[model samples]
Target chain A: MRHGKYRFLLGALTLPLALYGLLVLWPYLQAFYLAFTDWTGVTSEVNLIGIDNFTRMWSDPLFLAALRHNGLMLLAVPLAVIVVALGLAAGTRGTRVYRVVYFFPQLLSVAIIAVLWQFVYTPNSGLLNGLLTGLGLDSWRHSWLAEPDLALWCVIAVLIWSAIGFYVVLFAAAMESVPADIMEAAAIDGAGELTVFRRITLPLIWDSVQVAWIYLGILALDGFALVQIMTVGPGGPDNSTEVMGLTLYRTAFTYSKFGYASAMGVAIFFLSLTLAVLMLKFTRREKVELA
Target chain B: MKTIRHTVLTLWALVFTVPLLWAFMSSVKTDAEIFDSPWQPPATPHFENWSRAWEQASIGRYLGNTVIVVGGSLTLTMLLGALVAYCLARYEFPGNRTIYYTLVAGMLFPVFLALVPLFFVVKQLGMLNTYHGLILVYTAYALPFTVFFLHGFFRALPGAVAEAAFIDGASHAGVFWRVMLPMARPGMVSIGIFNFLGLWNQYLLPKALNTDPDDYVITQGLAALATSRGASSDWSGLFAGLVIAILPVLIAYVFFQRQIRAGLTAGAVR
Candidate 1:
């Protein structure tokens, strides 16, 4: 019976496992190996350069700038998204209508979202500037995606806008799971709404919050599609909006530096792994089991 | 206080809706109208814009391509994922846990890392720019989530029926095909819808693997339309393309909002 069971399992697993190993795992392992080589992506000859790509990355201005942009996004986007989502989620407890409305942005592709925002951020005829000028606040209407200092922030703002909705829905679901009676009891015990949220609600949904953080951090790290589509030169206006994903893409595809790009990929992999681990560790809290 | 919360919620909801509504409105407006009054009702709605975008800009081809790729990928992913998930969930064999963990860990592999090598791999297999290449990659990528979701679902089901089926002289394959799979339909539907939305909206994989203009997916096609030089003159058409691209997903979300929400939050909360 044991042998028969193993045979059945092997029969079921063989095809899927083969496909996965070849297409997914094999490529991943190849990428890790290629990171140390001097493969230009044009020719078949890939010479092992032994961390030269990694060493060069330390002094590469473009790479460093891209890393810095991703760093900023990693911190800013998640923080802004979580705070607003938490507020909206907490405030709209009993309602279902707002949840649907807020989640609308999450439905569209990042490409579509970027295109929509392109029109919104257009200089003269864009909705944002038009609204600002119509309100007699022309001074506040700088070119949203043009100024280098403000371009990445513009990208981050779009990131936050598109993302906050999903987390609002996510956190709302988590918040809703916390019994209303507990909140009411806290309210009766002279706790303000903020205090009740801080003292009771936040702790209970810490797991969800941790997951949201990791997800958002991964997203922030990969602001590639948005930056590729929305920004002036595709992570331009002086490369202020450059991100690691975009950098890796340009390195591999544009410059044809496969080895160097693979090194960037390795860096991103480690960075993402570290961030995920650190978030899981730091967000650890006493398990609040509700009866 | 309650009113304040409602107001804030309403305002934020507007923030999400108005941009999309604005894009939709702009899709029907003439270029002059879009530029002249950015927020006004179009004096004469150019309904032909959609037709023009469909016919002139090659968005129709892109849409067709996307449907094929997404459809093929979803079917394969669901089928293969169900097989793997059922095996891992139902049978306890040597290396079962190892296989399951490895599959789950594939979810965290940053796709961009494998871009260059995967490109070469596809090229070597003579599959670049083909539907098969994109479909296969998407299936492989979606396996982790599909297997993960379905594994949990299969575990939750009562195994007595499968046991009875086996005892009744049904082959293991017969029990799996006729009983276990039918019982896991809800899980399949949820994950299927999720995968449909995801694969449809996928930008990066298509961008990297399939660069042929003729074979571009909807996202790629829409992106090309937006960024191309002639975009300035075809603003209404561009808006129309955006609408056409987004409509299916939006409709799906509206109809299957509950399932979509459940699928999205499934991994997060638990």
Candidate 2:
């Protein structure tokens, strides 16, 4: 019986394991080796110059600028998403209607979201500028995606707009799990809504909050598709909205510098891994168990 | 306090819905009206925009391609993922923990890291630019989450049914297929919807692997349309394309709202 069970397990595992190993794990392993070479992705001949690509990336202005933009998004998007999601989740606990509406954006693809926002941010006839001018705040209107200073921030705004709803739904589920009696007791004992939320609700849902933070951080790191679809030159007005993923794409596919691009990919992999681990460590706490 | 909450929630809802509503409205307007009075209702609704996008712009082809790839990938991912997850969940073996953890770790790997090499890998296998290539890649990428979700679900099911089937002289494969799989139906539904929406909306993998215009998925096709015709005088067609691309997803959300929400949050909250 044991021998038959082992044979069955091996048979079931064979195909998926083989596919996963071939497609996913093999490429991941190759990323490290490719990072050291000068392969142009067009030829079989390869020469590995160790750490040269890494050294070049350190002084590369475009890479640094892209890294800076990702850093800014990392700080801004997750913080804004968490705060707004928490507020919405707290304020609309019992309402099913609003939850559905809020989560609507989470359903659309990044490509669709980007295209829709391009119209919203169009300089002359955009809905945003139109609304602003209609409200007599004509001074606030500018080319949102065209300006170097505002372009990355505009992308971050769209990121927040699309992401908040998912976290709102996530936090709402976590909040619903908090025992109602505890919140009611706090209210009766002269605790206000804000106080009860800060004291009771926030602590209870800290686990979900931690996970959401990591998830959003990972998302912030990969603003490639949105930046690809929305921006001019796909990372421009002079690369202001350039991201590592986009930079890597153009470097390998357009410039044929696969080796240099592999270095960038390695950097992104390490950066994301480090960020996720650090977030988990920083946010680690004793699990709050309700009596 | 109650009124304030209602007002805030209502305002947020509007912010989420108005853009989609505006896009749908704009899709049915002429180019001049869309630019002239962007917010106003169309004077005469232009239903030709849909036909134009569907026929002239080739969104219809892209939609069909997306459906095929998503359907094929979703079916394979669920089947392979369920089998592997069931073994890990139910059976004990020497390398069981190792295999399970290895699959879970695949979730941490960002696809961007593997893009360049994966392009070569797929090309080497002669899978690039083919539907099977994209389907296999999508299935491979989706395995981690599918296995993770279903493992928990299979473990939660009562083992009595499978044991009873075995006692009735059913082979192990028969017990798994007949008894165990049906018990995991709800889990399958949740993960199925999740994978369908995800695979349907995938852009980067297809963009990297499948470069042929005829092979373009919905996202790549829409992106091509926007870039090629965005600056041209086809504003209404572009809007119509956006509507067509988003409509199926919106409809799915409406129908499977509960499953979608539960499945999405399951990974984070659990």
Candidate 3:
């Protein structure tokens, strides 16, 4: 415990510490500085612009749309992942066959998921359209990913479908980890399955739920690949599905506005960090009864 | 009630797996067959799609790149994480708690926040498209959970033994590397599986950093294949690429599911 004895321990930890500083902390600090500059990615000159980037972001319609898209995605994806995953988790608790089938999709990469759904939503030639025509509901089929008004929701739906399996498995594990004694007590008290879930299971796995929420928030902010692949760069038919990452991608790559992209990146970083911290604060260890 | 429950579960599972099933079926179909009977299985199993995808899409090169990045990242991360974890677990240094908490905070920071500046940092380091650059970044990003997970594991080790080693005048690094790390094999395995799976499966960072075909990781290469003109509608080739991309993760899950699941839930469960 003495300083002299701990020197070797400090030496062993130094490399990782330095790497973290250089790669994560330094970049994080640089991103904050870059946010105040006006450096297009293509140029070397970066002039100080103060809070202009942040100020412009506030009134920027595209930025607002991106935020709205994020809100919608967070609303839709997590809700779907939660509700359906819980349902599947409950139903497949004792079914080996169902568990394998449900968890199979989690094996696919997000790129593959995006591509597969892109085909499935390929306007007129898509499987959905074919099925619609076959069912004599041809008019009900629309340009799913090509319509400005509906593309964002459509992308959100695909994300929901792709993400639900992973969460289902996570929730199932959490639910199974709940001690059996409390469940039996609830059951003895005339609690049905739903009643037991509400009173006993949910409270027990509250930490897992909080973790899942934080994970989902980060996923919402970082999910640019799906928009990039499915929306083909404009985010959607009219940039409707442009979330923070996609906007950052556009600013950095498309517009070559390195400074602006860095600023957006910082915004996303703080947004997610604040949201995660708030979630953890609310779902503190004290909130769980552990009874 | 039993039959109804079985039926509902079966239906839900089947519905959920449709995309995966569709991808598999499409992977073996000819292009004409893909467009003509999109939902049907191939009349003739086109195994050539895999070969073609591997050859034309340059998946082999991408896989190689991925292996280096993922392997290098996991090695560096585990090395660093285990060391940091040992420091936290065994040593009482100034600001030890602060260091520990800061490491934990890194895991929760979203990747998006670091991407912009991270790109420039890598560029500045002349590691823009190199494996080392990505590996270093991955090690940093991956260190938080690695340390967090390994800290619990190291603390779980009996401190009396470490004290005995200290009494014998074993250097701190000697105790950590020679004694502690060997004792924490299970913890190391769990951390390895988690980090390997994560680094292998990462998409955005590779895509953002590496723009050229030669430097591309599997995820980025697969995306490129899917988006290219001749490549876009080639469902079979795309499926083939998907198969290649998911194979390692699937193998890992099959072999090390317990460790991975344990590692994944470590942060949340605690």
Candidate 4:
């Protein structure tokens, strides 16, 4: 058995490691190098250019717009998702995790969600207008995804709608783990629901909410699928809804400027890393010990 | 309080659930009806929309392709992920922590950072439009989440059973294959179901790597259906295609709600 032990260990580790290296690690390293070079994605001849792409990115309006949109989502979507998900999850302790609300959107492909919402936002004969017309609120009708000012918000709405259910369940699970006696004691002290939530429920489930912040923050930064498939011009109604992921994709694939796209990808990587670290730093709290 | 809560929950349910119900309902409405009366029940249910989307729009072929690739990759991810987790968990060998952290670190970086090189890597291998290529890459990318999630599960298992198996002259591989593997079924099933949903809905990898039209997976095919001719004249059929894409996942969620939820919220658990 000892003789075969080393062989078994080596055998087990080899394939997964090799696959990981070839597909994940190698490409990641190459992406950094390619970000600094001029690889047209069609040409075999590559030459290092030394941060030219990064310098160009600061001046490029499209990349800046994409960065700003990601930042906006970074602020807006996580707050909305956390607020709504926590509201829905409040007091629903031990609720079974089978809500169709989450599964419907969470399980479906982005393509489906995009197409579904496209019809919903269609200006003339779409669901939103039809609902408005039915409610005699004809003054409210507009092309939801076509209006530049309204388009990013529309995408953010979908992002929040699709995301809230999972966190609701996650927070509810956390709430369940909070001892019944603590909640009961809070209630016995004549605390209102809001007060109890603020003083007790919030701190007890602070860890889960923090996890949610980081997850939703990263998710907000990667709205490629929603923005790509749903928005007008695929990235525009004046580029209002363009995101970093879509920018990287279009920069690479549409323009075939792989090196430039690689630069955008690296920028996104550092942005997310910073976002994660910031969330961890700012959201840190003194541990709440239950008596 | 209960009344208010129920009211909010009910309204919340309607807000989120109605769109899917509407998508399914609209799938059966004529294109004109869908346009004219978005909220009404269809005047006449167009049962043929499903068939049209399945046959003329080629959603059937794409679904078949998705099943093959997702199925192939899920199996490989589970087997390899479990093996890696087991070896790392149960043994102390050189480079163990390094390999574990290396695999776990794969999760932190966004896939977009790797997309450019990964595309060329596959292209250089002459596997740009191949099933095996996508399957291998899918397994490779999925390794991180699987190993990370299963690592804790493997660590928690009792050591006595494997010890007893070893005393009975079971080879190390035999003890793992027989004793440890069966004990890890719950973890495997949870992650497996989650992996299925994720890989099933995967659009980025396929959209980037597999551009050949003949190899469209579910998301790619449905995306094409939206952009091209079917989107203009055949709205109901497009809705049908959307429903067909989502229905299997909804069904799976109903049955495996426990495991699926566990898989999704596992990171939040610890």
Candidate 5:
């Protein structure tokens, strides 16, 4: 019976495992190796140039710029998302109607969202500028996407707009799980609303908040597709919104430097892995002490 | 406090819906009207704009392509995902924990990490820009979450039901196909909607692996329309393409708002 059971287990797992390994894991392993080599994607030859690509990255201005943008987003996106999502989740009354509307952005593809927002940010006929001009605040309108100082912030705004609803629902779900009586009790005890939220609601949902930080952090790191379709140069006027994924992508396909691009991928991989572990460790330690 | 909350929520909802509403309205305006009166209702709704985007822009072609690819990938993902998830959930064997963790670990990998080599991989298989190639890649990419979600579902099912099926002389395979699979139907439907939306909305995969215009998916096609310089003057047509791309998702979200919400949030909250 045990033998037959093992047979069924192995038999069932074989095909899915093989597909996942071949298509996902194998390539990831190869990327780590490829990072060390100098293989122009066009070439049949792969020369192992150890750490050269990694060393070169520090001197590359574009790579440094990309890293700076990603880092800024890694800090800004999650903080902004949590604030708005937490507010909405805590404040909203009719969740049914609100959830549907708020989550609408999550339904559309990044491509569709990019295209839609591109129109919204259009200089002359755009929704933002049109509304501003209509309101007699004409000077407030600068080319939202075209201006170098503001372009990356514009991209960040879109990212925040698209992401907030999901986290709102996430935080709301966590909030809902807290006993209603606890909140009621806090109110009856002369606790202010802010005090109750801070002393009570916030503590209960800290875990979800932690998870959200990691999720949104990773998302912030990969602003590739959104930045690609949204910006004029994609990375754009003065490279203000250049991201790590975009840098890696252009390196491989546009410049055909597969090895150097693989090194960028490896860097992103480490960044992501570190973020995940660090969040878990940081949050888990506090989680235990809270209990 | 109550009034303040209501006011804030109302204002935020406007922020969410107004851009979409504006986009749909702009879709029907003449190109000149789009530039001149961006916020006004069109004098007459140009319904032909939708048809033009559908046929001329070949959004219809791209829609067809998306449906086929999403359908194929969704089916494969569920089948393979269910089988493996069910096993990991129920069976105990050597390396069971290892296999389960390894699959779940794939979720943490940003798809960007794999793109440079993943492109080469699909090309090596001579499968780039082809339907099956994309279907396979999508399935592989989707496995981690699908398995992760369905594993929870399978684990939550009572052990007694499967034990009864076995006593009735159902073989392992028979039990899984007939008894276990049906029992996991709710989980299937949840993750099914989850995967459907995900695979449907996929941008980077198709953008990276399939660039041929004929092979372009919805995202690629609409993106091409949006970015292509020749179509720059056709703002009405471009907005029409945007609205067309949005409508199906909008409709599905309306109909399946409950399942969609529950399906999407289940992983995060759990």
Candidate 6:
């Protein structure tokens, strides 16, 4: 009877198990295999030119530019988004209207956000430039998305602005997770609000902050949709906004160099994995202060 | 202090809403009015733009396609994710840890990295450009995160319920579908909302697989409208398309703000 029951359980679980393995594992494994071969994605003729893809990646100026763009985004986008969100969260607590308004952008798709910002960054008749010209600062107005020197920075600004709502909501959620009694106690002990936040609140929600940092780091490297829509994959004027994600995408689909793109994807895969592991390890090392 | 807090949040919220409000208002404005007064509200609101956007851009077709893809993917993913979560949370089988860890590992792997291989795989299956194909890919991609989120909720449930069901001469499947699932509605709802939004907002997967214009989802269609064919001169029509694209998402957000927020937080936390 026990044997029959075990057999039934195995039979029931088999379909789901196979589906998961086939769906997730199979594609990932195939990706690894294709990364090493010169598969142009047209034919089954796979040439195993060992390490050629990787060697080519080292010399690819496009890949390097992509790395640089992502690096700059890493430095700028999350920092800007989070800092503004932190300020918003800190300033607005226990207010219904505040919650509703802060989450407005979370509803927008990347295409919509890109289009909205495209209007804002329009050169002559743009709301931004119109304001600049209206303020008698015509000299200060410049082509925002077209200027190569400032283009990536412009894209970064759009990304930061569009992503602010999510972080504001996240930070607000994390801030709420901090115990009220601890906050009140800090206040009673003659600590200012800023002091209370810096000392008491920050430590308790360190895990949540780490979560945000990790998520943003992944987003930083994997950015594509907005960059593609805003800057057009080649990163206009001179590959200025060519981040790694866009580069890999164009390499695969646009250029049809499937092997080269897969190789780039693998590099990105390891890059994200390394950062995630390092962040998790770093967080794990910190002592959890249980009050 | 309350007044100060309210004022600051309201101001920031206004800043957040301005672009969306602008897009929405511009969608309804006449072309001449859009150029004449970019910031001002239309003297008489033109709701016809919504219909125009729908008809001109063939947004109806795109919306229908999006619904098919998102709905198909959401149902399949939630069922599969909940099953896997149940297995991981309740049963003790050999290789259970291996299965759980492997699923979690897929979460860290970015979708971009798998696009090429996934495309070829879909092509091999002769499913590209079909709703079934796209739905399958989405379900597979979304499964890991859904499983991860649902696992937490399932684990949090008391074991006695399942134990009682098992002792009462119920089959394992009966216990899962009848006893466990009904009780896991909140978790399932949260996962369902997350999958809906993610699949709805998706651009890259559909773009990569479906080159046929008929199969284009709203995101891909809106992008193609704005950049490809519509890049000729005036952007009024393209902006109209953009507004059409985001309207459904906005409506859903307005209606289900709590569920959406909780869904997002649950995915991230797990």
**What local lDDT does model 3 show for residue A16?**
90
Candidate RMSDs in order: 1.5, 1.3, 2.7, 1.5, 1.8, 2.3
Say which candidate scores most in lDDT.
2
How far out, in Å, is residue B90 in model 4?
0.8
Q: Which stretches of candidate 2 lie over 4 Å from their true place?
A: A1-3
Chain A alone, TM-score per model = 0.96, 0.97, 0.88, 0.95, 0.94, 0.90
For residues B1-270, could you state the per-residue lDDT of candidate 1 as single tens digits? 778878888888888888888889999999888889788989888889999999998889999999999999999999899999998999876888999999999988899888899998989899999999999999998999899989999999998898888778887778789999999998888788778878988999999999999999999998877877454468888999999888988887789888888777665654
Candidate 2 on B51-84: residue-level lDDT in tens? 9999988999999998889889998999999999
What TM-score did chain B of candidate 1 earn?
Answer: 0.96
Measured against the true structure, the TM-scores of the candidates, in listed sequence, are 0.97, 0.98, 0.92, 0.97, 0.97, 0.94
DockQ of each: 0.72, 0.76, 0.57, 0.70, 0.76, 0.58
**Clashing pairs in model 4?**
none
Real A-B contacts recovered, model 1: 0.68
Write candidate 2's Cα lDDT for A1-291 as tens digits.
233787788789999999999999999999999999999976667899999999999999999999999999999999999999999998888887898889989888898899999889989878898888889999999999999989999999999999999999999999999999999999999998889998999999999999998999999999998999999888998999999999999999999899999999999999999999999999998888887
Model 6 spans > 4 angstroms off = A1-12, A42-44, A134-136, A232-234, A281-285, B1-7, B229-234
lDDT of 6 by residue, A50-152 (tens): 8999999889998998898898888787677767878887776776457666776766677667767777777754677766776889899889888899888
* Better candidate number, 5 or 6, judged by TM-score: 5
Global fold similarity of model 4 (TM-score)? 0.97
User: Over all chains combined, what TM-score does candidate 5 have?
Assistant: 0.97
Positional deviation of residue B181's Cα in model 3 after best superposition, in angstroms: 1.5
DockQ of the two-chain complex in candidate 6: 0.58
Write model 5 residue lDDT over A1-291, tens digit each, in one string.
323887888788898999999899988888999999999976569999999999999999999999999999988999999999999998763555786788889888888988989999999889999999899999999899899999999999999999999988888888888888988988999999999999888888898899898899899899998889889887987899899999999998899899999999999999989988887786663442222
Off by over 4 Å in 5: A1-7, A281-291, B230-232
